[model samples]
Target: MLDTGCSVQGEQGDIPKEHPVLKSEKEVLEKVKLEQYQQIASARDLTDEEFSSLKEAHDTPPSERYAMGKYRLMAVYNICDTTVVTAQWVADYDNEHEKKVYRDLCVLSTSKMQDGLNYIHRMEQLSLSYSIENTFEARIPHKLDDSQYIKLKYAVDILAACGFSGPFSNDTVTAQTLNDNVNQYWELTKDKMQHTCTTLGLKMPMPKKWVFKCQLGFLNMVLHSVLGMKIGSVNTRRKMYHLKHHPKV
Candidate 1:
């Protein structure tokens, strides 16, 4: 069974033989971090540590509600509500999109992602090291440190926005194709999001405040854990985002 004996066991901070979902989460987390590094390094110089700090925001959940490999983020933008987004539409979307995905005619539902988030919240409340937390926290990015929390981490964005909806069939999705899909979606999503932001006043994301906090958090982890440098004066506030989902997301 996919659920039987599915657990996350680790040494100090590393998990050996990670669950499949956790493996996917880790891959996406590292991938996004690396992509952020390249972009920042291209614009300016950075050290490994500096890059890690700056990479805190790139492709982050705060910046994008829906992007690559983010299943739980499908309903990122708060464009509509469940009252308007009926279950029938969601059902139609699930059936229609899955049936003929090549048309890019299918849209995502924030309600679906919300349901996932709800389940994740329940799992987390029940346990800290819950296996679900590995994938949930990875997809959510509620933390800015290396506490095994790979947030905004998954293939939902890249797969949905490009591979699943683009001009290719599932049979042709090879490594090269997936790579191409990711790049293509990255460019296209930026343009679409910018347009939406400008026209709809969707509140430009990734404020400077977030970057600073993420840097602080990462540094704090390094200090308290790695170098044992507990300067004790740093106070961090947890910023939360309420995931709003609409059927058209």
Candidate 2:
């Protein structure tokens, strides 16, 4: 949770002059935002419908409720690796600037990145800790330098495009650059990197593949695999049957 002890009013006039580093960082952020806005403004303006769709996709307006609410149950997104937590806030701003203060509390293993309110944001006040299921590296977001932010963002992109082999494999990787963020992530996950690098290539017993031909249901579903695509009335209406013989499973 953020420390809310300081008076919001006086800090504006007093803090920046006293803390030059804070001033400098805020300036850098201003420059970055200006560049972003300029790029957006330079684009061929979108149709109002397109703009509305994009805005709706981008933002979820926050609520005014500040106090902790009841612990209602919600479904979670499951993944196989590191934990990720994202918190969003439209900063406590006057109505005019509130739209511009939309910031994110992006926490990861070694970094905390936010747009507004430099270092002393409110979330620190909670005194919380996170634990990954089996790993014991503390999983704390360490101080991320500017360069590592690039690395972490790349790591995130690789995650977003998980199970995509056409881009990562050596044969098709000409589309990727040497210092690309995905490549950086490929380098950072050392165990994964070693496995990909071939510490040992052991032959495994031949595996059986499952092939089923089916059609007929409220929803028409077709699963395509290396075997082939086939249509069958397997589970339709009153009939549901498996293959007459097994493939030596």
Q: Local distance difference test, per candidate?
A: 0.35, 0.27
lDDT of 1 by residue, 1-249 (tens): 477865566553554557676789889997876564333223222344644554575555432322221221123322223342333333334333233221111222223432433554455445555546565445332333321111111122332433342211222334344445445554554445444334322344544553433433332332222212221221232222111112222
Clashes of 1: 14
lDDT of 2: 0.27
Q: Give the TM-score of candidate 1.
A: 0.18
Off by over 4 Å in 1: 1-118, 121-141, 146-152, 164-171, 174-180, 188-249
Give per-residue lDDT, candidate 2, residue 225.
11
User: What TM-score number comes out for model 2?
Assistant: 0.17
In model 1, which range of ten residues has the least summed lDDT?
A: 146-155
Write model 2 residue lDDT over 1-249, tens digit each, in one string. Answer: 898787666556666564887878889997875554333223333344654555556453222011001000000112122112111111112122221111111233124222212232333222123323335464333322212233223323342332222211222221223125334443455244323223212122122531111111100111011001112223545232221211111
Q: Quick one: best lDDT, which candidate?
A: 1
* Candidate 1 global lDDT: 0.35
